[model samples]
Target chain A: MNATQSLRQDVPEQGGRRPGGHGAAAPRPRPGADRDSAYWWEAVGEGRFLVQYCADCRTPRFPAREVCAVCLSLEWEWREGTGTGTVDGWTVTRRTFHPAFEAPYTVLRVALDDGPALYCWGCLVGADPDGLRRGRPVEAVFTDVGPDPADGGPTGGGAFTRVVDWRLRE
Target chain B: MAGTGLSGAAALAGVGATPLSRDSGVSTTALACRAILAALDDAGLGVGDVDGIATHRVGDSSPPWVVGPALGITDPAWHLDQFGGGGVSHAVIGQAALAVAAGVADVVVCYRAINARSEFRMGGQGRAPAGAFDLQYQAPYGLLAPVQHYAVPARAHMQAYGTTHEHLGAIAVRQRAHAAANPRALKRDPITLDDYLASPWISEPFRLLDCCLETDGACALVATSAERARDLRRPPVDIAAAAWAGGHSTYSPPAPGGLGDDLTTSSAARLAPRLYAMAGLGPDDVDVAELYDCFTWTVVVQLEDYGFCRKGEGGPFAASEALGIGGELPVNTHGGFLSEGYVHGINHVAEAVGQLRGDAGPRQVDGAEVALSTGQPGHILAGTSALLLTAGR
Candidate 1:
């Protein structure tokens, strides 16, 4: 299978276990997608990173909004991102608050390169956490998570839905 | 610099709080009533005199409707139950002040009661409800706690200004020293910088000591017209000014063309001038300050945003002797949320009132005249509120 296909087929094990055996993990909480953000989650399920742009002002925004904060325009459209960004800030979770997440995972705040000033948060994957620094260039990767029982059923078409993860750029 | 017309129109007559503790072993309603009654007694007012009630909460505490009648306030002229955390602590006071000034209510009591440790703990399970629209973006990645949300900006501040963990540790250590003298402080044991550094990391860049204690307690303040305040038992702390500002939500996208550079800056930067303009006071006039200390970094950022020091210099400013009781500008003299209990910033207001009224026994700043008390500094929610208070002559 192609790399993309293999990634698509990867479904997280029960309880959403991380690679390192810290212990038994709890099921990761599912994203509560509403009407505004349901489409974005669908795109992520297909391994595409999408950002919403004001149709009139052409300003990009995230976390789904009804009107443009700049121009107050109702017009907007979704555009795929370049999956590339710079690390604006980051933190290492030494203590886990949620049972689903294991300790020692790095969470990154990335300022996307495709948009003028967009930023997103995700767990760091396939990269050394120590290498993370301000302005470090990074790219996104898609990972499949469970058909969570908390979600009742699959959000996407299949049994798993994809979420964004980050890795340092070569 | 138009005045808010709220300057000196209302005065905080009294402030009261339950003893800060790990477990109160009572319902939130009981805690609220105890604080409200104490504040009324402090103000020399009867329960029948309270025509207004204002409070803010995050699905953790009792509301006005429940606490109002329990206190024998049958027909409140005005009531507010704002939904938020530390962001609205001062806004409730501001709203109550406006209500009294506008003649909508004669006596307004602002209180916050939370069993944050024993019940509805912050960063605990089910704290972020399923419908919290903003959590959709963050919770999936295990960014559910305030420490995680705040750590991002703490890291950003460290990166831009070369701020060190030692600088953050200095705040923790100093505040603990202050708490050592505060009888009501939860963590009164003095901590050294060595102790601060040795504390385990809750979120990297944020050691266990960098965060505030989650305690179970309640705090209340009484606001009335300046005339009524003079008749009260305790010396009034006039509400010289109140200002609240809301910026882009931290979880939402930054404004167009606005890079993450604004991350290091906070809503305090936008509202400080307005707060001062309303008060007709400058930073130099502030004899003592009770800034929100949800995290050590917040104190560092607000010290700069409030014009106490230059931007990017809060690190060194925080580490300096300026924060001590006898320093140029004593801050969080009641130990703040760092050393004192976190009653969701309302306790900070109580501490400020104590300083202004000369009721603070040992940790008080000598001859404090004007005080600045603030809510959350807007790092997490981009919403902040503050009050400028002057001692009644």
Candidate 2:
């Protein structure tokens, strides 16, 4: 067995950040919302994860590029994911770069089972650094990270910027 | 076609550096100009002799356009203003070789000067500009610094190779030992694996000891045609081979399509064979080397990528006594960016030149004839590069 496989656990595990109490700030840097990538963020707010596929060559890519490398086409479309993925790699951040995050959180790179593997970054709800292994099955769990909508105006839990997290599947 | 006539076409005639410190207390421009003058003087040339200039900038250092006139060279025949950081190090040197080989100009000077500690600390947690599409994907996830970006691949290497923290600590301890011999090294005291493990974790699997120093300094070198160099003062360190190869992009893990099956493989994987072929030599032929050490894992990765060991063997290879002065491959003889100062990777070039010239004093590799210097890899836009230098007539 490979080194990663040797560390694998057969039991299902929980991963992804739990919602903080009412007044917690977003614990990460905000993505740049420009013309090319606004649609991806919009999908995240609606509790969906999206990846870009080239309209001409039918090639899928992440973070949205201007032109398709294969067919040189400038056209593309956003496709919803299948929500199933495998943990291809991960890192447990013991130190927080942002104030919103507490110490010791896990970031996993999940290759979505959507046709070609579309790699997305997110927290694994309850996984520890030692417990993670490659090839672990996971499914998406979008979490509300924006300001609260109950306050009505630009207060807590805004609807525009929810984050896509993940949980280990049995 | 590897190396072809490019071998022995240009020579590094001189190398210079400002005293490394946490704060230089001077402007980056002044530091850059001072190092350039020192290099030119070491080459037994004046500002007028510098007909070509190549340097990299990140809105911090003085560009060649600005540095040239300040050095009294009003107009240079060749100039290159490379972008990004250590990943572009040897590629900038390769630019100087290209200029000299093509006869665009002679007496090309390559330099990198930054007030990295005082003005722009590399270790800070500020977000990078959303210039590349990959940053758009990574920034929102709190992957803020080079340490954070590299952690993804470092962890993959660990999982694939069984590389432990002790292995990473070995690299730190060995480089620190080399640094202790060199006076210019910033952090010279020895560190045990226990001390390394105890150092605070900047990122997962990466402790404070794993990261390189944030230094305020400048390093510069003069390159000219081999014929011209023979007439100069110091022994010419012939630019035997300089090759810049295409590598993976900045697209996050489960890399973009062209990166192939290995997330743990570095650009040096493809770059080293090409580099050695161009130099008409192999890994075993190198007498000394200066691999870029932006992080300790980088040293481990490059050790494998440069053909020093097998892919999964980097950690164990580093943990052995093989990387020290009397060992198989004496790496980072001037301590490396981890312990030496961070002048991007130009200090690697400077150290290589010093080794080739038999001027490294106590830390010099014995019979160090053929030297290798490599740049950081995996910059989607900048690519990566390596250089082979040899003692010349």
Candidate 3:
């Protein structure tokens, strides 16, 4: 699952088609940002996945936490992820409530070996929808989801300008 | 139940509901007031007689204070405003029962009113407030809405227990049959297993038929001392026990391994024993079940959690006729949130009250002496709650 050999082959090229669009145009809804989670988002923007690791207990928490559940230790560090994980479970949303999230996209619950089993959004590029199975290996991929370059320059219609998504490991 | 102090202490004296619909064409406030008034009337009480109130809301419903004023009760001796979807279903009523039992307040009315379908559908792209850890981690991945959130566990349950969509479909079909007899049900058309299987998938493991209705309506119940209820207009359903508790700490900065141990189980596992202990009963004593059916998978999970069946056996249990109206337990006799409507879980309480009083016309469980009603499966922050209603003492 290491992308070093592939020279970051898992990462999408700067200007490619963003996911969840069915040739329809809609602004994506961004994650609600606040002081606690801004650092996590910033790391994602830089193409690095970070999990809050408790210094005292050696436990890693996701969604960012102030105090460790196991140790109640306030001391923690943002550990860089290996960008590799296993699919604990997944769902292909055939219909959705958000217009920006086009239907028929698979959402995988990835159990990061080093982190929590969240990372709710998933990606399985070039794989059949039926191919999705628990325990399948996957690696993280970052995509710049901005105005399509072909739309005569930034119409500025999308959620996060860039997001850290995932893809199945070859 | 030696310590079942509240047993026969309070009773559900009245149950009332507005018409279930996709659109009520009225403000949630108006709907809440109307339901409250109707319940008061059913209880043979008026605005002046009401001394306490309680309600649960999901942002789409009006709060107790607003509804109290509209119903001509400006000042109440006891009142509670709870949050969360199905978790508060019976917890609010339990709180009210405690109030009445402790002599803090009497003549308490518990209600839940929502215009969910018409205004701010729960499935829509409504982001949680900032700093909510689960939303921050999940929203970026487009894991919005309860359907998607719930599907993850349903998938895990299937993978581990080999639970199939057919197992879940049977629940939908059976509940729809119950709804067919309920005139107030929004979707009363009887559906077959094939119809359930044929429904399009909203989220995998959850087809369109597996989801609860996006309902616009309100349901309310009146609670007072069993002594007071004897003189009321209707027969009383004694509040044998009402219990609520947290579980597994799944989504709250979840434990290291994610969702802790088993995904198929819920907080009900921890709650069922306590609830029955308070009522001095067990699963076998329950004549009817009104388990929350926010999604069919939830019902399946809860059946196992509450000791109706062994853990991995929920799929097969759901597939059997054991949950039908004439079957052993007769779950969700009013069709549940799946087919009847989603007034949170208050409707489940209403149905239990009806069955216990022998007021449920076609769907009533014969000689139902004990009914078990559940709130949402306890996983999310809302956790879980339940009540055991028995025929009056």
- How many angstroms is residue B79 displaced in model 1 relative to the true structure, after the best TM-score fit? 0.4
Error of 2 at A93 (Å): 2.2
> lDDT per model, in order?
0.83, 0.77, 0.79
Question: What is candidate 3's DockQ?
Answer: 0.38
User: Candidate 3 residues B209-311, lDDT tens each?
Assistant: 9999999999889999989999999988899988887755344555543344455678888788888888898999999999999999998898898999998
Ranking by DockQ: 1, 3, 2
Against the correct fold, how does model 2 do in TM-score? 0.89
What overall lDDT, based on C-alpha atoms, would model 1 receive against the true structure? 0.83
Best by DockQ: 1
lDDT of 1 at B205: 94
Ranking of predictions according to TM-score: 1, 3, 2
Mind giving the per-residue lDDT tens digits that candidate 2 earns over B1-393? 245658889999988889999999998888989899899999999898888988887667889888888878889999999887777888898889889989998989899999998888663445333423555455555555678777777888898999999999998988999999999999999988889989998777899899899899998999999999999999999999998867565453233445533568888887887788888889999988899888888888888889989889999998898889888799999889889878989999999998888998999889899999998876333468889999997
Number of the predicted model whose TM-score against the real structure is largest: 1
TM-score for each prediction? 0.93, 0.89, 0.90
Error at A40, model 2, angstroms: 2.3
lDDT of 2 at A152: 35
Q: Higher lDDT: candidate 1 or 3?
A: 1
Q: Model 1 off-target regions past 4 Å?
A: A1-24, A152-160, B1-4, B126-131, B251-261
Candidate 3 chain B: worst 10 consecutive residues by lDDT? B125-134
